[model samples]
Target: MKKLDVTYSANIGSYLGVPIILEDNTMFGTLCAIDPSPHKFDKKDLELMQTLANFIANAIELGQAYEIILAEEQRVKKELELAKKVQTSVLSEPVQLEKINIQAYYQSSESLSGDMYSWFEISPNKFGVILIDVMGHGVSAALISMSIRSLLKGLITSISEPIEVIKELNHHIFSLFNSTHQSTYATAVYMVIDTELKTIEYVNAGHPSGLLFLDQKTMKRMDEGSIILGIFPNLKVDKQLIHYNEPSTIMLYTDGLTELINPVINDAIHTVENIIIGEPDNLQLIEEIKKEFVNGKTLKDDICLITVNVE
Candidate 1:
């Protein structure tokens, strides 16, 4: 009572206060009660006051934590948007050449996709087409994919051959992200089309089988896929080479499309083959796929497809 250091304590004959501390041992503020008349506080009264302070501290902490979480959510949303933009930029448009008309369709279950398809004009008469699906989805797979995307043009141009391109890809995965978890890898289909040679040379690394329409009635399943990329130091890859007997439409896709159509991969492939056989033209096939899968259904994974027409 005699202490002049107490600010605004002149009218208050009694005062009780306790500091509020968070669970992390950080001090927040003071909890206090003041009265004009002096009153003695018992152990129970002090305990109750402390208990109230603890409740307030917990409430404040909860509010703070909620705010932090909201801020983090907004930050992640913005980052994913930016990443989607960057990812979209790298994806090449369909290569509409004189002898070949290549078209691609891509959709992500999330803002960012692990599925990607692109083609590079390796030479005047030849172009390289690739479609890949990383092991899982989201940020980690996306990062790995972008890293691989950066290397695609050079690798496809210099290597040229499908077998060597995939082997070098495996080597890169092993060398670059060997630090990642064991399951970090991607299934891919790399193809080199020579319009002049009239041959399609391709390598499938644990991806879905590509569909090739030989004629209106006949279809060939390109299922000679080896193990996935990012596995094994020494890899043996046999490139499959096929000469188009006539004007043919070749479809390369990730597993996401098949997985959506039917749980069984082979059955889904069969369904897709039937659909493509019904409408073999590039635009018609893409339209059919949209009507069946992308019309109203919500996808569970990334879907990417590439179509090449040899005329």
Candidate 2:
């Protein structure tokens, strides 16, 4: 060993060092020892030093693994945030027209949701609205929901009929899953409203029945269609028509709204029916409904609601 300034100044006599090498043969540093006076380390001392070096190496490796884990967690969190933003951006905004007023509400149980909805004008006086709920929650379901949203945006442009649109979507989703060998499904309700004719044509694909409030004490349920999408390739869905003779309200929602824990499903539906029967303003009704599922009560799944008031 060279007599460096530090060694000479400190009167170091001997040194023992072992490289802290990882399992991948990457060197982190060195486990070293120095002496201030002339000394000789015996065979036993050398073996003990080697053992300590091994311990140090293991600790260092564990620390590095922990750092890697932390970095991966941060990356996943950021990706989830971005996904949530994209999902929220795709949701439909409230629609206010001369003949109808519509409002929608959505809430994700976690960082990402599987519920989605859209509303657009098909013709000059005709409007199309759709609500979809993927089978599960989280990133996978959110991605499926987004894919369906993109497909529907294109399908609605060409297919004006609700049943046809659902058929096309089901075919596409089923084909995609068949090729990928992954089984996934979604429930949806698609509706088309004609202002001049004062009629609504809709098809429900295994989703919860929509509530049509006829008057203060009267409400009609719309529950006509085939099974859920993505299960079968060639499926036929039936479309139901409602000809409104007077002012009315139509409520479309996901099962999450009525599938709460404290109140049973039937009771929750009754509660919502009561709220719709009493509340006149759609926005106020949404707020009240939200209150029912809040205050330390976590949602079991994503919640979505669409309210359309026909005048």
Q: Tens digit of lDDT per residue, candidate 1, span 1-311? A: 45444634567766789899999999999998877776676788789889999999999999999999999999999999999999988999877778999998888888888888778999998999999898788888888899899999889888788888899988887776566545477889989989998899988898889999974557988878579888776688988998875789999988888888999988899999988888888877988998997778898988899888887
Q: What is the lDDT of candidate 2?
A: 0.85
Off by over 4 Å in 2: 1-16, 33-40, 261-263
Model 1: lDDT of residue 30:
93
lDDT of 1: 0.86
Candidate 1 Cα RMSD after full superposition onto the native fold (Å) = 3.6
| 88: Cα error in model 1, Å | 1.7
Q: 43-145, model 2: which lDDT tens digit per residue?
A: 8878888788888889988998999999999999999999899889878778887788999998889999889999888888888899999999998888888
User: Per-residue error at 283 for model 1, in Å?
Assistant: 2.4
Q: What would the TM-score be for candidate 1 when compared with the true structure?
A: 0.86
Question: Clashes in each model (backbone N, CA, C under 3 Å)?
Answer: 0, 0
